[model samples]
Target: MGRYKSFLRQRYRAILGYTGLICLISGLVIISPLLALLAYPEELPLAWGFLVPGAILGLVGLGLWQLLAPKKATSLTLQEGSVIVVLAWLVAILVGTVPFMTIQGLNFTQAMFESTSGWTTTGLSVVDVTKASRLILLYRSIIELFGGAGLAIITLSAIAGPVGSGLTSAEGRSEQLAPNVRRSAKLVLAIYTGYNIVGTIALKLAGMGWFDAVNHAFAALSTGGFSTHPESIGYWDNAVLEIVTIVLMFAGGLNFVTAYLLLKGNFKSVVRNGEIRFQALMVPLCSLVILFGVAIGLYPQLGKAIRVSIFETVTCFSTTGFATVGYTEWSSIGWLMLILMMLVGGGAGSTSGGIKQLRVYILYRSLRWEIRRMLMPTRSVTEPSIWQGERRHFLQDDQIRQIGIFVFLYLILFCIGSAIVAAHGYSLQESLFEYASTMGTVGVSVGVTSADAAPTLLWTQILGMFLGRLEFFTVFVGLVRLLRDTRPILT
Candidate 1:
């Protein structure tokens, strides 16, 4: 047994060592919900809910780390990094469900769904928060806060080496805010912490109680839409709260690099950023279109219409999933507009999930260049460039092709997910809406997801949320690596 354990460690240091450390970290996260009970002691039994799994996970993590910790820190291959990310999420979802199972009569499927939703920052839930304990509610919010921080960034500060950078990149973050991996990780953590503090305070001043404010701030900045009330943000009916959440959600959905630049007063870079410019244009334009639809049919009053429009549009664009008004009552046009927003998603390298605005900008620019090429003579040349932080670099053909493929795969997955849901007897539009919500990681369900939902549909939604959050490739590559890794054992 000892010889085999040693052999495994020697062969796969990155996988076993890093995954063990991550499990340890997740165990700590699982226990942190106890602080919520300390802050608001609503249900005493809920402490046991988290404690049992937390302790078991901690022991397992300790055992794995002891057996597998590498003698020295080393870089991880892209495949290794991908495996670590995927493995960490699988364990996270498992441990995250402990409290849910303890809290109610939820089966493993329902608990897994809620846990995946929270950790992925997808915000879809089968449990009702109104009936849930404060500790459970706080635990859900805490999941978003850390989940938004990205497991790589959180664990990177402690794990020194190029492995951190590889893990960050695997999770879709490309920018480095500081010199070393640890410093970069810490800097991003600081930025996220600052945002959490400021957002919580702002929400509190906007009329939410301290607990609700903290939870909503965590959810909004994480783009996780778990709400204390069933109506989401609409329950408050406070314009101030809505506006505060809008700002936080937008900020949350922004690229960390852009946010860092803006914080440093680099306004010019933000202005030149292609993703920012695209979001600035697309958000308001889509809102106006939805507004027009709502004005004619849903809300006749101008003020009411405008508020709902901006709230829903920002929520959808940011992939935050909060609802000020149910789109079920909206016209088909309204639903289509929001669905398009969900498909476009928010900035890459941010907590928001979907096909991403960066790819959309690239694909759109590529489209125009294609048309120009078709119209011009064969000998003519057109420079296709996009604005980055400080410079304008011409877009490469490979880059364009990759972006196109990503968008194509994303739409394909959406259709596949929709088909799975539609097989359960839903209409085309309903399936599209539900799958779009899952694929975008945007939790605004059109009546498909629920506690009573079929196990197949529930699991499909779970798979969709996981794939969407990781943007597909990481998980796929991880699976391939897993098969390869296990071949020796199987043989």
Candidate 2:
């Protein structure tokens, strides 16, 4: 027992220290909203909401950092990395909830839901945008921006040390653009920041005010669907704005590695990428289907129908969830199609979420390979591979098996969440669509998610968003490790 206690103390010291550092960073993030006061001095009274929590968190983090700083340099295990990732996110979300509760007067449940949605880059919202202050709206966007890049990546970029590959992998960012994790993290941030600046400027030139442009740029690039207006992109009714947004969304959905390649004029690698190929096929195919089968009848004008189809399809396929139109009036076919798109999601190692395109494409390739294997002679063997970036990676059985398990678990959770929502009297289709949106981190709504939603429903979607954003395995493994480490004390 004594030995086990010593093991826990030694092993967890580094983890706690890292988590403390993340909390300190989160403290800075929480207080960032106070900057909005410079533009709108009327919102100055709401500053305390951010200040109180930020100070408390900063102090707590300082204490933990001092108390738990590792005595010597130690390597972080996968389990330790996962725990730090989960703890960092949870701390951010919890701290993020403060402003919503204090300024918006949202109850704990609603605030947590908003915080989770923001951090997960899941744009589902309970706040009434028409009534919410700009400060609150910017706060949501800021969190989404940071959340999309990930806290772990931010930490890696800030500190110089051997943080470990496990930290990046646990955060669902296994692909690094540079050999050094810190350099890769900085590159990601640089690219991400550059895009946001460009998006904001483009939107501003496209006729949006600076405030709206900045917020939408942040939300769009982060693949977070939060809008300043209730109508979202439809509020502008400007094709140019939508075009700019589409470009931003597409950029957000590309894997950072692929984006880097494109930026470097490596068109050949981008063309050969499996996930890009999948997206290229999916966007047009789904758009055509929606346009012909569903959108045309809904809109009398051909141009309007085509626009809606392409926009919504990209929104779902990219898991960006910035809808130009509401789904309440859409037919069942449209709902199902969007749900499928959400499930298929965007590129791996991107801000967007869902069962990433890489996995689905690999799964499709694996299916073909399995059939070919069965048809071949007993002595025959063939290797299957896919191009990710500049390299062709051979598909391994273990990799396929892990992806299969992940998809199976993802679908099971989707079904379970849908059923839970359906039990509240929504039809199976509505329940399925809503939960699919939740679990995919896609924020499209069919009127099920609102300010008045039941706490149980909100909580269920909260869990879904958390699981979706963290990609399940990390959260599960982290929790398991947490429990195992504390089992002796529990008993």
Candidate 3:
């Protein structure tokens, strides 16, 4: 066991060591958004205080990285590779919490929850937007930006992987977007930033103030739902702003690989990707259902109805929890549909969360195959399919088992979290919604998950935040590693 620990340490030191360095990078990024706002007339005591201390930590991290990190580079193995991904994400979220604590006046717990929620593209928050500092508001969006682009993917992409090594994901966080991970990261980051700037400027032109516009721009591009005001997009109360958010939110939910391909004039990539088609087709479909509900029952004004419907539709499909208005007030069918959409989420390789369209497509294909196999096992060699090209491939039996296991785990975790909330004296409906918000990373709740709640219950929220950000697997593995590390080696 000691031999294995030494082997693990030396074999993947580069990937292993960079976790701290990336946290420093993330810390600096967290502080970067605040510099401009510090120039504002408002005496942002919390913002400046948070910035100085966090910046120092980042510098300390950078200095330590320079001194203690590997002099020579090495690629991580599959096991080490998975560990690196887990550790890097954990550290990124840790550094991301600084602004929430120092600037936003959230204690470590709420700060961690909000930061984890943002970076996971899960829109949960405990901060009251009406009273937040402008700089802290931007910090929320920046976290979404980091989460939207996959900080781990960005880091992986920035560094050169070893010879003959490739980053591959058969399921969660799958395949590289470019020939090399670093180059792919560069391409995605460029596109991500471009979209954010465009979204911000368009909102500004549509009459939004600089602070709110830029913040929403970050949120929309990351598909994160944090806003400068509690009512979210509703706070703007502008038709043009809603239109801009709808467009940008959808853009953020798309696969960056296809985004890059479209930019390069390879329109075929969009045509060929199954999940992209599902997203394109489903967005309008969900909108129509929401439109029908809002137009016929929810509202009397046609324009307002359509606008709200579009906003909510885009929000749910993008896995963003921002509400132009209260969705819980809608019809039962409408509420259920939105809930279903929240669980399904947007495209893969995009900022959105939930089960994702790609998995849904695969699950559907596998289900159809199962029926066909049962009906004509002796005659039919292969099942009929509709998704484009290679993506049309159905889940194999092993893959199906894996998916089943993950789904079970996801549901169980949600149930346990909900139970914990209920034990804390929240009502059943609120408990369920809180758990769903955490697991979905959607951040919408019945006002149950908050800081004023009991401190004894902090661990429940923490679990939700960790699992929400890592999307279950990493948090589980990291916990296991923690336990394993503490136990003496049996040998």
Candidate 4:
């Protein structure tokens, strides 16, 4: 026990120091939105809402970094990495709340919900954009921008050291665009930024103002559904803009590795990728079903039905959550279809959330492989493989098992969250739809979430968003490790 304590003490300094460095980066991120003041000088009075917390967090981070500075470089364990990732998110969320609270006069619950929603890229906002100032609205997008890229990735890109694979993997990213972790992190940010710039330009060309263009670009490319207008894409009601958003949302939903391959003109690899193939199959089929089965009946015009079906289907499948229309009047079938899409979500290693298409594709292939195994003679041996990026990787039994476990846990949490919402007097379908959107981090709403929502319900969705965005494993393991680490000191 003494030996164990000594070891933990030695490691804790490095862990806390790295965490402090993450906090330092998050402080800079928090302060970045103040630059929006230059674009909207009228909203300059609200600058203190950001500056105060930013300065305090920066100073606190500096102090921790100095005080907890490790004597020498030490490689972080998975547990340490997970704890740091979780702590950074919590600190950023807490600091993010101050702006909403100070500028918008939102209570703590409301402010935290908005902050969590943005950071999680869940886009389930409580803020009324119509009432929100330009600076405040920009700040929300800024959070989504950085949040979607991830704090850990940003930290990795900005620094060099022992922080590497453990940190990246703990943050739910595994694939690196470059061989070096730092280079890969920078590549991700660069790719993400390039997409954002293109998206902004496209939106501006489609007739949006400069501010709206930038904000929507950030939100869309992050797969975050926050909009400058309350009606979302429907506010403009422009097909050109909706098309731009759809392209950006779909781009955002692509795995970073796949995006890199595509950017390098490796079309063959992109085409052969399992997640891409799954998306290609899922999007069109679901869109057609909604169009003919539900949308046509709802709207007599074929064009409107087609537009609504395609846009909403992509949004849900990508977990992007930008709605061209509401679902208050949609049939149960339409809602169910959308709920399923949200549950499946986008490609792994992407900005989007949910079960991830790669896992779903694996499960589907695993079922086929199982049937083949059952049919084959006892002496037969076979290998199953799927193309990911440029390589055809063989699937291991343990990998399949892990994917199954994750899906099972995901469904269990979804059910529990849905039940909590249903207990609040909503219909089962509405509850399921709302909670699916929450758990999947898809921001489409059937009206269950609001600024005036019960704190319990809001808190429930907040937990759902956090869990859904980080996925379950990293968070659960991080919390358990945290308890284990602190127990010695507490006792």
Index of the highest-lDDT prediction: 2
The alpha-carbon lDDT assigned to residue 30 of candidate 1 equals 89
Query: Looking at candidate 2, what is the lDDT of residue 226?
Result: 89
Q: Write the per-residue lDDT of candidate 1 for residues 1-491, one digit (tens) a residue.
A: 56665655565765777788878888888888787666567666668888889888877877777677776676766777788899988999988888889876589999999999999999888987778878888888888878888987887887755444677777878777776877888888888999999999999999999989999999999999999898999998888889999999999999888888999999998999999999889888988898887644578778888989899999999999999877677788888888888888888889999899988898888888889999999999896788876668699998888788888899998999999999999989889988888989888988788999999999999999999998788998888988876755444
Q: Which tens-of-lDDT digit does each residue in 211-307 have in candidate 2?
A: 9999999999889888998889999888888889999999999999999999999999999999989988989999998998899989999988998
Those runs of model 1 whose alpha carbons end farther than 4 Å from true positions after fitting are 1-11, 161-164, 380-383, 489-491
lDDT of 4 by residue, 62-112 (tens): 877788857554566677888888888999999989999999999999999
Which pairs clash inside model 2? none
lDDT of candidate model 4 versus the reference:
0.89
Q: Model 3: per-residue lDDT, tens digit, 363-461?
A: 777787888789885876874444432245444677777767776787787788889899988866667666776667676666776768776565577
* Alpha-carbon runs more than 4 Å astray in model 4: 69-73, 489-491
- Kindly report the root-mean-square deviation of model 2 from the true structure over all alpha carbons: 1.5
* Clashes (N, CA, C under 3 Å) per candidate: 0, 0, 3, 0
How big is the positional error of residue 476 in model 4, measured in Å on the Cα after superposition? 0.9
Candidate 2 regions exceeding 4 Å error are 1-4, 71-74, 488-491
